[model samples]
Target: MSPTCELADLVLPSTHWTERDYLADEVCSEWVFGQQKAVEPLYERKSDVWFWRTFGHRLSPEWWPWESDEELFDWQLEQTHAGVTWDELKEKWIHHVPMMPSRDFEENGFGTPTGRAELYSVIELVSGSKPFPEATEPKESVYATPDVAKAYPLTGVTGRRYPIYYHSAFRGIPHLREIVPEPQVVFHTSLAEELGIERDEWVWIESPTGRITMRARPSDGIDPRVCVIPHGWWQACPALGLPGYPDGSSNANTLTSDRAYNDEFLTPGLRSTLCRIVKKKEGE
Candidate 1:
């Protein structure tokens, strides 16, 4: 579902959470509760339970316990607080269970070596994870060797766009797009003058892995050496129209690389990749 979907022969629309009999083991603040459905579904969509149970019965007839979702739901509710039942949830829509602070291990203190908070964790030491939060240089940095900087001069950083859009999602949402119309690449005012890049000019940000285009906005708040791009763009918007999406609206991932990463986890270096900014020519 990223870069391209050359292998997908057909696609199906999915039911939104609001459209079905919703359920979740939600943990918020100090209590846990089971969520219930809100409204009836409108489209040609079916509940996820139907799909899961159908697949389960097909995959393992011996171990699959239930003939219906109601049977499975009843089985799950039986594990809740002894006094509560699914009937209560159907009527009240939620049942809250207080976490057992009543446990008598001296007011349920943290089960640590000191019987209190331990700044240095013995648990991580045993698990072989990093015991302390340590700062390390990015895999790619502006302070890197002179030759490396010359080749890819600017640092690329990706950040959240807005509350409405989660990554590349909801750009097609008209009201959300009205709040923040388009993606923009911000730069320091001095850097903009140095590069002869005018305000609102479209610029291509090229990393070692790939390149994407974004509009330029000169601001003193941003660092000249770093190019901050918003996250989650795809080539499927109707604004592009063409099956061949040559423009950078889908250029979101092109500004990042996986060459360097966190030592403990192989997470991509989204904020550490090096890139060069270029003003786009006419019609590009």
Candidate 2:
């Protein structure tokens, strides 16, 4: 269970990887991995396939004809790759597909309205945007919003990953929590000195949108004007005497804004957000 699950009114027990059979593939790789189940589902828990198939059957029996995960896997394999079977996958555990020859763009041209790897897109022009690519400053940054930048001078990058935990996961695990006890605002030594913050000391990282408190972790590798704060810090490790950090307390998204985004994809400006660090006083 996770922080999201903790807040859920109705929780359904799902099978762990050890209790489920599945297929996994590495990105951009020709290899496919068959994940064999090591153990059966304990208690009232069931595999996601079971849960979905059960609900799907009640909704529409015609579409959810597969009675077992193996049947579904067979159909998936047939659709994705020919000459591959479930039994062979279970026995081998891994299969390497032969890579296809690269398409000759020079001979056949690219896949577009105006092929040949168009630098100026006809589709974009038709959509009333620049035909060619144009790089611009983010709408909520030090460069674009100078007036707001005065209060928030540092560039705050959110969701810095830790080896021990995935985004907002495994924090409740004692061993992992011991490895990374608390979330820290990682910045340059110069910035730490300027703000009179020491290593492992609590500090407030305030942006124009919002603010969050985290332990200060100064490093020489990062830029003085930039700070990296990790996300997913809600779960508590009772063994470490660490309480769960409330949503607005340490979650990086609390300091981010959804008001402005990229012109092309509408990705919220998380990395380019402006912020400032201040050392936390006693009892605060």
Candidate 3:
């Protein structure tokens, strides 16, 4: 054990090592193996709590006693006899959780130095960015300026699917691929026709910043101005040598912007952008 520990210590570089070496070693274990064990438990626990809180009333009568015909004690005995453990039975049947009423106020009641919800936030004042009570404009209007809007006409939205094998990652799988086989650029039928792009054909989507190639999928469900591309596509497999797809293809991140995002929260707006699409040439 001591020898193995000594060997591991030797392999793990000191804090003074450069970022690239640190990242290379970190990725081998942290991304490849450690990620699942680290993340799955937090996700599972949150999901379980959400399930219990959201639907606990439906499964047991005691959860809604004012509406229930039976008493709480009767419900407990009934649940316990059915082979549920005491803790599980109590969580399902005996807890009396209160529900809060939803309210919307012009001012949410917290005051700053001005003693009111500042129409302009303190940060805006401090940073001299833009004043608060900012005008509400249609999302596409940001690009409506004559010069900027012409180059990037369509609203490009991304990242709206499950994490594992979303977008184009699982496109090579038989059963899953049958459902959705490739990175899809979703646009309205009229827009697709205007661009002379056909459904399921490979098209190059471009922003002023960057571009990536994906299959077009025209749809009426999305707003006419909005175009969607789901996220999470791994670089293509080199060993398999698949046609029309090369190594390092299909990551939506390639076409996304790196601008400072919206002010409500520090979260990056991966879902919103401006782009245009064109069909790929025959070869190369």
Model 1 weakest 10-residue run by lDDT = 240-249
Ranking by TM-score: 2, 1, 3
Give the 10-residue window scoring lowest on summed lDDT in candidate 2. 23-32
The runs of at least 3 residues in candidate 1 whose Cα sits more than 4 Å from the true structure, single-residue gaps closed, are 1-10, 28-39, 74-83, 101-133, 144-146, 235-249
What lDDT would each prediction earn against the true structure? Answer: 0.67, 0.84, 0.54
lDDT of 3 by residue, 1-284 (tens): 12234457444222221111111113322121111112323222333222343456677736643232123323443433443333343345332223334343444645465656677777667765575666543334344444555877777778668444644445455555445555677889988888787889888888766788788899989888777876665433333443334433555666665552555454554666777777688893
Q: Give the TM-score of candidate 1.
A: 0.74
Model 1 agreement with the true structure over 190-277: per-residue lDDT tens digits: 8788878998887887877888776788889977787777766653445533232334454666666677676656687765577778
| Inter-residue clash pairs, candidate 1 | 168-232
Indicate whether candidate 1 or candidate 2 has the larger lDDT. 2
Please report the candidate that would top TM-score against the real structure: 2
Query: Candidate 3: lDDT of 72?
Result: 32
